[model samples]
Target chain A: MDVLLVEDDYYLADDTRRVLAAAGANVAGPYARVAESLSRVAQGRVDCGVLDINLGEGPSFIMARALKQRDVPFVFATGYGREVLPDDFNEVELLEKPVDPRLLIDAVARACRKHETSEV
Target chain B: MATLAGAMNGPGADRLSALPWEQTPLGPRAGWPGSLRAAIDLMLGAGAPCALFIGPQLVQMHNLAFDALYRDGSAATRALGRSLKRDDPDSSLAKAAGEVFAGRSILLASQGWTIGASPGTPAFNLSCAPIRDESGQVGAMLVLAFPVTSPARLDAGASISELQHRVRNLLAVVRSLVARSAESSDTVEDLAAHLDGRIAAVARVQGVLLRNPHAGVDLEGMIRDELLTQSADQDRLNLGGPEIVLPPKAADLMTLAIHELATNATKFGALSQASGKLDITWKLDQAGARGQQLELVWMELGVAIASQAPRRQGFGTNLLKRRLPYELSGEADIEFRPGGVVCRIAFPLAPVAAMGSSSVWGVTTTAGDDA
Candidate 1:
């Protein structure tokens, strides 16, 4: 399974990649900003993406929209409580930080299943 | 004041010693080594009594009222002198010292007899106590005394009753400032803007201390009132929320912040143009076991805007970005869409207790403090 990890924090990105790689998922570059990560999604097909709710400038909701446009499944991770999220994004799953390995693996699996079921 | 201090300081040490309060006096003898006249002048200058030491003996003595008033000072200062074993001797000085050394406290009458060798009726308060030597034996005693003037004597005192008058004067000053600043504006828009500027001038960073008959405000309701007061025609605004009580500072700042937003909307964004409408809403959420948050939403439509984002930080931006977040323990964001500016502010609900009884003006609110 190929995954696109979109997160601004480098240390968190590295740790998340290591855990996903060890779990047998082939992850692409862990892009830092909404612009870079959305481009990677535009360029290729990825099974899933991880997003940090607040990027440097504002919300990463734009990237979530991009993922939705491309038919890729994803979840939100944020330091701010979920209450800070805008209402339109409520249907998507929310993952809290410091991302635990098992939770990340399970969320990815869930996303992949939803994607597959929706395509059907 | 002068008489009060003089009565507190003059002689009658035996009589002063019977009082139950603290008194210390100073006089010419207390200021000896300097000219006795200088000591008297110094005592009179302070309008209070001075501690006196007579001759080489340094026999301790104090007026009865002074001894009673300032027994602690007498007890502490007495250690420097010789212990007198006898009772109140007929010697006016000895009688004063005996009155001081006899007890731990005293009281003074408004009209009292004086102290000293000639026994002149100088108004003063006197007190004294025994001093102990290195061997713990009673050494010479020390006298403490002072004087107090009658209340009528003081010229500068503004009594507590004057507070209401001062408040009224302050209100008049505020009204004058507001009128002065608005002198040039003619149109309604210009007047509203001028009024807003004036309100912001005194708009404490926190909410207004409103005259709530019930004494507390419903914060949600207050925010609506603030928004409505500055809002455009009724057709253009929408508000919704369950009631929440907020202390004065939080409610004030929140009101001002929202006022700025509404003002901006009316002048530049949605409310300015026809067909524009604003929807304001709020809800409470528990972030965790320790934190609670109030999340507010502002949705606008129909107003046309050229910019998708605000290029520079205006006062409104700074208030929302820095002041609201920092002061209220909240975070806010404003986004410019083709439709209008969508703003959201989230704040921690805890710490309101420490903010004290804050009230917002022109808004009604209630809290558990009363209900």
Candidate 2:
């Protein structure tokens, strides 16, 4: 599985990538900012994405939307609950931290499945 | 005038009894239901600020703490038996009453709650809870005003939701700290000691931030505290610069960075040797549109550079070189010179007053701390 991760915090981004890599998943750019992720999403070939809601600059909805335009599924890895999300993102799955590694892996699988099932 | 005369007849309870309860939607006091009666008793007898909203129509009664809110008795008496939302559609009192009647308990920062007989309406910290009736149904809601002064109202932009986000983010940061600290240490003992020191650094920042939120964290005080914790000799170390209040967001990481520098100095630099000395100086400069910039220089003397240089990948090294610039949108440079390690860090300052502390008007928040 190919998963893109976006988080501004250095330790969190690094730690999350380690967890995903250990689970045998190929992690894409764990980009620290939305602008950094935008170009990567433009490069295509993404299966799913995991996003932190609030970046240093603002919310990561821009990255979330970029992934959506590619028909890619994504989950929000956030400190906040669903209320923090915009109304348009009701369908996105939310896993509050510190998320269980198994839960994160399962959430990623479910998000990836959303991509495959929508194809039919 | 007559309303004031009526309200002044006696205490809050007596004034409440003086009301013609028979004409109200809640009906005569003699025939009032147990739940309504219980809530009324609670509000009347309570020593703290409280308001009771009975039934769906939102009839109201309050305690002495809220006496200022009803000081204008004409509005107070006329508001009885009427939906609080009737006139004040946007008020927190109305919103709390509306939500409570709908069966959801909530906390609201009341911008309208008057403190004492104070001239202006200062903000209040209010909590709304459902009061159950004899039938186990939400019959009334008790709205209690916590004695929070408008100044300490961290809720200005920092609503409860924002606080939750910060608190949760803090937890995540702590979790990541534990994992990363373990990665750096060679022994379990090293991990324990390093992790404890890191957490202590984080806690020291949090403690100052919490106590004097109005007065932003003092940079000199923060530096001194870190060095003091390490038991560094004060006379050899020189701290200079004007009093700078670190923007709350920058305080934590800055504290950690300073902790790292102090630890390094204690182990290999100034604090370690009799001949060593450290000079930490800072200057505040205008950075145009980005506001003020704090330029700090940490220069240690009398220590060998090459042999004392810590591992390049240490947590302190990464934080200073990478995280500081990224998180604070600032600049940092650590150069190993013959004299010692010279580290320069500079960052733009954001205002801390935005976080809380309504002290701009020269008044501290009330002492009640009911929040």
Clashing pairs in 2: none
- The deviation in Å at residue B187 for candidate 2 is 2.4
As a TM-score, model 2 comes out at 0.63
Lowest lDDT sum, 10 consecutive residues, model 2 chain B, at B362-371
lDDT (tens digit, per residue) of candidate 1 on B171-266: 433454354335545676866775665476334322344343123356656656656666567777777887776654456557666777776776
Q: Which 10-residue window of candidate 1 chain A scores lowest in summed lDDT?
A: A52-61
Tens-digit lDDT string for candidate 2 (B168-190): 77788899899878878899998
User: DockQ of each model against the real complex?
Assistant: 0.01, 0.16
Give model 1's DockQ, 2 decimals. 0.01
| Candidate 1 CAPRI category | incorrect
